[model samples]
Target: MVASSILSPAIADSLYAQSPFHSDQHDARTGKFWMTSHPTEPGDNGVVPLMKHWGGEVASMWVRDTELLAPLREIGRPRIIEIAVPLATTPDSYSAAKAVVATFGRSIGAIPGKGAFDLYTNQALPPSAVLAIHTEGDPTFVAMGRTYPTGFVDVDAGRWKELTGEDD
Candidate 1:
């Protein structure tokens, strides 16, 4: 994991919505709503195009781990957003991690102590994986998750609570 920064969910949401490729569509196969990019290829999910736009080589998973939230909290950033890219080799993962850190770490704020940005790459991820943005205190914002064919840019509040069983 590289040292990284933080962004409030509101800011993240705004940035994502303002992105040129944003989309909101319901997946009939999974019966879920997604705010994501349009598919780059016909009959293809949006993962490939999203990764390309986001500067990731292959499909990746972004998770917010509760365990890593402490260090960020100490700096007054109680929320964390992680990006996990899947690669074919360990070296590739490391390089990708560095790229992610370089590309996104600066725009957000840096972690004060020990640099707790946890960006990694997985070698075992299946095709068309979902990437999620997880936060600690904000239950109203659950960015995205897998169990679907395409990647997601954001998810609405009602759907988030419905999926996670979280109360407002």
Candidate 2:
């Protein structure tokens, strides 16, 4: 099924304003800032899945659940959901991780079933930087969180990997 929720780019920027999750406006291909990483679900203990996980660093810019539900209705609000909120970030990946210390409540690995990850933005409309979720069949779940000023794509993968990983 398709996602009911849609992230507005303008709104997402405000959410991560001054934060590190900010992506490079310039089109310079350095690292996999826009690629997928393989990792088990959050809290999987060890075994990370060989799934291509890709998302963004900004969000819908809504602090309250109400403001974020209209778009949610479009996707039927399934049981299992995986959320990733990009926080502030530095120039490099390693530095970005270090900056995340000040931010804790970012990126959530939720569990929601009967759906899949579909809602996305960016030039290619692929998930990047903020608020990402998907649910597709069996095992309903939802993990929603926001990162600090320092955030990176890899770090985002490792932190949320536990949703389906076995190695703590």
Candidate 3:
């Protein structure tokens, strides 16, 4: 939910939409699934590491910068070579949200990206972190500030469609 250059709302939407929560793999890789533009083919690689930790939980894509894009590209999910517009918020707004989320659980920073405000959930995550906040049918949660009600970057839907070819 933290703003990230590595992840985009479009890519996040695709990944979230494509995930089949059940055990889609037979390698005894519980929670393992593929991320592909072609859903029929098995995923290019196992998201086991990401899955083991984030499996069965709604995840917020938090990236520090474009560095996370390589992994996402390797995984073959939707990759936007050029994002028309990315999202951002004032440091004060981010800090305020951080305080609210910190009340429930811990927050972590993103690496290999940019600015340090890329706070994401990791250890000691509370159940509330996975709670959904409907704001355009994108499976959003509340801890992160969306433009609506918070004046943060909500990842403009029109721009997302232009970049990823998916309408919200």
TM-score of 3: 0.18
**lDDT tens readout by residue for model 3, 47-75:** 22342222223331333335433445343
The digit string of per-residue lDDT tens for model 2 on 32-149 reads 2332222224433321111211122222222334444344334332322333433232223443343433234333433322111122223322255334344534332222111311
Per-prediction backbone clash count: 2, 67, 2
**Which run of 10 residues does model 2 get worst, by summed lDDT?**
47-56
Model 1 TM-score (2 dp):
0.17
**What TM-score, over all chains together, does every model reach?**
0.17, 0.22, 0.18
What do the candidate models score in CA lDDT, each in turn?
Answer: 0.34, 0.32, 0.32
What candidate 1 gets wrong by more than 4 Å, as runs, is 1-74, 82-84, 89-130, 140-168
For model 1, what is the error of residue 60's alpha carbon versus the real structure, in angstroms, after optimal superposition? 28
Ten-residue stretch with the least lDDT total in model 3: 34-43
Give the per-residue lDDT of model 1 (tens digit) for 1-168.
122445455434544454334323212212222222211121124343333222121111231333333233344322223323344423345544554564364447532121222232324444445444444344422223322224432223254465568876
